[model samples]
Target chain A: MLSESETMSRFFESWRRSIFDPDIPFRRKALDVFRHQVSHVPIYARFCDTLGIDLSAESDDDNTTGSDDDNTTGSDIDNTTGSDIDPTTGSGINPPSGPKKNPAISQYSDAAIPLMPIQVFRDLLIRPDYLTIPEAVFRSSGTSGSRQSTHEIADLTLYEESCLRGFGRFYDPEQFAVRAWLPGYSDNPNSSLVAMIDTLIRHDRSGLSRFLPLDQPMHESDFDDIREQNKRIMLFGAAFGLMDLVDSGAPALPSGSVVVETGGMKTRRREIPKQELHHRLAEGFAIPRDAVHSEYGMAEMCSQAWNNGSGWFACPPWLKITIRDPQYPMELLSPGKEGLIGVADLANVHSLSFILTQDRGVMRQDGTFQVLGRWDHAELRGCNFLMES
Target chain B: MMQSDGQITRICKAVDAWLGNESGLLEQARERTISDGLFTLHDVGHMLEQVARTVTCEAITAWVEKSRDSYAVQNSGRKDSAVYDKNVLCLHAGNLPMIGLQDIIATLLSGARYHGKLSARDPWLLDGLLRLLQKQLPENVITWSTNLDDFEELRADRILFAGSEASVEPVTSRLWELRAAGKAARFLNRTARFSIAWLSGKDVEELRNKTSGAESPGLLNDLVEAVMRYEGRGCRSVAVVVAPCELSDVAGTLIPALQDYVKKYPFLHSIKPEKSYWASYLETMDRDFFESGPIILTGDTDLMGKEDVVCWISGDAMTVQQIFEKAGPKVQSIYTVENPLPLYTEALSRAQKPPIDWKPDGVDVLRWLSG
Candidate 1:
């Protein structure tokens, strides 16, 4: 048995290697991490057990919900919502009110791997008791007046590495002066996005990189001067915050400067379509619509996916995106099919690696995905006050 | 100035008169609500019909008759009728457009000195109606205040608040404060709640016949019409679908049905994309959650506590019963398709047929309001 520090160090090492190994099979790494987490993370382990996926057993437990083998024969059909077959169970009547028996998976597929509901992190720290105490805790913004999700990191160094490498892989940091107008996250030191941006700023090595203060308006002249200096700039702001800057008569930035928008308008303003928002930002910044980037991330995962003006986002090498049929969690949707997003971030080794998100998106053949909006049933959590422009 | 029954009849007649006129205050109210994006013009028309039916002389007469027979207050009130004239401060929730109109009418019929604080979200519709009522009734009979503090300042013997669950505590505490200060009051607090619909196979089949076609999963159309009314923002809206055990496969049929219906009838007051994104973000983090079009299906039976609006829950009869037990006071209405109404009688304040009135949760306002 290894000490907690040693176990975490091993995960970090695996992540570092995986980032450089794109050719590595997704499932092989995912399954390896899944099996490891089942033994270490209590919440995740219980979830797998409930789903009847026992890693330690001679074979993966095949306890499936509803009657997949013979949908007509599974549970007694009773009339509640008028004889409509329950989507999940072939026959309804609550499956005999006892523990769900393990149903055999005909084939060993990635879908068979049990997923931890993403909400567990919002209400519980995914930290196992045997694991080392977390050195830092990152929280989602609670601007919506609901409780926010918090990610406890046993190893801050691993997170720093993940953020820098994941970002550096997509866009070169040294060439750009990272100018972020992320007031909501920046104000809260525990914010993961703020910490990630801080890393980007530090990596820029230039004094030009900094989070702009909300109260103090940066004159257009100052921004223009930075462009004149021949420095590439990445301007990041919350969607609504960026809207405010433009609405306040802020002139277009120098060409080639990247404007990345993260958090949505929330309740600060009436919700606008992403196309309209991007167009407005592009028109205001004098940049191509594609020049306006979107960052898809949350406190629940260790990795962030980036969309460079294309409506679709692509995850980094260590992170994988899986679109699953919302009604059937075990069923994976093909490319171009809209479904719920399931993320398997190898960098999330310290916590639960498999996270099923509430975002609705369509995966393309090339693996890039476009987020449609929210799954209507997803609960709105916390205040997004800081995102208001 | 008039007998309670006569005063109620006059107010009902005034509303009917306004509604009948092509260019009356009711029309103006309807148009304003449409323009405000609170409800679509079609749905507003639907809401007006419910309002019209609720205040009819027939409905009022039957209600008064029932209350006189059932309420102890009525039997004893003739000797000590002073309580009948007590002031009732009405705090109307604006979540559902014109949701306060029923209560406003009820308060007036109770012969209480009705002072209402209308929801800011929907100030125009009810205000227009009230102003029309003032034209026929004396000023002493009914009135509305501009602000909560002003409503609070006026003399009141009873308090009636209809709002979100979160408002319950603060309102109660404020009333407590008022009582501590020597201004005591009796109260009825109606908080946020959602409704459920239970269907049998026969019900699904009939729904199919009435909508689209025989094999097209007509229950989906029925649910969409019920839940998506007012964009699923109102308490009367059917938020949860409780189905029979054999119909577990209904989830699959309903998901696609929802997608098609939403595309056909776009939400008038749709949720903002940003908030939707945040909600999705929060949901993706949870394992027990799943989505099917506008309907979210969850294995977590206790979703009522979370106020999960617009979702379907699958369970056996016993599981659903347990859920109802757990959901207890939060559940407002449970509509059963083929099952007997008595099956859910205990679970709800009143188990009625399909088209339910937009009443406050946990209370039968008309029953208590009529004397």
Candidate 2:
């Protein structure tokens, strides 16, 4: 048995190895993380116990053992209390509190990757005990007097590895002078999006890459200075902040400038469709609609999927997005069909790696996907990105 | 044309008969709402049932008697009574389905011309019901419009605005402008507000046992009745459930119970609230609320305004009261198993349907309307 520190260190090493190891399939790496979490993470272990998953059968062959024949999460059970009881169907998957199945391991399956619904992070910060104190805690931006979700960074370096490496795959920070117009994030020190942008700016060393003052109105002089530099520019902004620039008659950008929006419009602006918002943004920035890009991510997951000209997002090797039926959260839907999005980010080794997001999207056969805002009842307003995008 | 008390009672009787008739006005209205995707058939049936209960001859007679007995109306010779008999405009753009019925009925009972503006969300539901009343009574008794600006053109004595705080702000300013210009118009505004239920640990335990388990069918139905009263869209709907117990314990039982309720009612699963609403739901979840079937929030209570999401906070009696007090009048109702809060709190048992005599935001609109 390994000490808590050793266990966490081993998990980190496995995560680091997966970042470069091309031979290890996504499924194998995911199962390895699942085994580590089941042994070390208390909450996850309890959840597995609820699902009747045996941790001892951690080998790849046993993944198919606990696959519930029923698609439902086994939520339907009615021990009636009142006289007025309507007929209720009980087809849900029940929590396996009965005798354990001590049989041999079965076939491998992708469903074995236990998903921590994103809302769980809001209830409790699921992190390893090795680091009681987090290096940084990224909080989601919310309306006034509302609760903000926090992600404790046990290893800030690991987060940087994911954010920077993943960002590099889409846009080169060295070639572009990064200009961020994230109002809520720029003002808030506890924003992961801001922190990621900060990392990009710090590494640039060009001095031109920095946060733009979003509190004040954008002046033409600010763009004039950027245009004079004549370097390839990458402008990152929250939806509302970008809308402000657009509404204020944003100055035309220099050639090769890319505008990437993350967080949707905050309560400040009205919600427009993605196509309309992109068209308006493209018009405001004087760039082609294809040049106006988007970043699909949240504070709950360490890895991010970037949208390169197309509305569809492409994940890196370590990250994957699975579309699940909104009605039946556990059942994965076929590609091209819209449903709730489930993210399996391997980089989130310290925290729960697989997360079922409220975000609604569709996955294509080409491995690219499109986030169609949040599922029903859950708000999908603003930029659809609840975090500092 | 002015209506007598006997005439109004006759009209109410006709309206009631129309509501109960097969494929009648009420049925048509319910169908319209269901077809428009504004509410599930069960929810529309529930709200319509409430409207039917409230629009009874007995309730209207009681309101009439109460108004006649009041000093304002008795002293018609007094200068204040001169404000009666004005064209009252009803701006019915509220989130609550069939909430416009209240203002329309109030206008009729007060013996005033009713000019109503139906919200797009409600569409033809209100108009269809009103047309039924129009068939029996004078056509000039009630008038409705889709355009809010139509209210400005019609000369009026009063304007009754119904909607969210944000929705009412523009209308209030516009009405105030009219008032400033010496238009003899008084405003009766009833904006959207959230309600909650405070369950004690003992109450929760008893319920857990009575239902045979935590996820009891009856207990799940009770919770469903509270949250899904109006698809969790109405302000009067219970947006949060507070318990004076170990939060984790409450979450343990409450999560599965709500899940069962949601699973049974699949139509509710199809709803995707506005983006702004989803953001707010996420905020509540982040704070201490866990999202199961309904968003279960446990911990200290923050202000709540979102429609679809329900919050669950755990605290002792004093702590729960403090949270309730912070909610202020924004809390329309606090459904408690018993009166556990200190005196002066408006805590009551859960109502299966809407109450005939209820003051939203605790403001006596009946007194204002009757006078």
A-chain TM-score of every model: 0.80, 0.80
iRMSD (Å) of candidate 1?
Answer: 10.7
Give the per-residue Cα lDDT of candidate 1 at A301.
75
Which residue segments of model 1 deviate by more than 4 Å?
Answer: A1-11, A18-20, A58-107, A378-389, B1-352, B355-371
- Tens digit of lDDT per residue, candidate 1, span A261-356? 885666378767778889999998888898999888878877889997777899886788888766454557999776788888877766888887
CAPRI quality of model 2: incorrect
Which structure among the candidates has the greatest DockQ?
2
Candidate 1's TM-score = 0.50
lDDT score of model 1? 0.61
- Name the fnat for model 1: 0.00
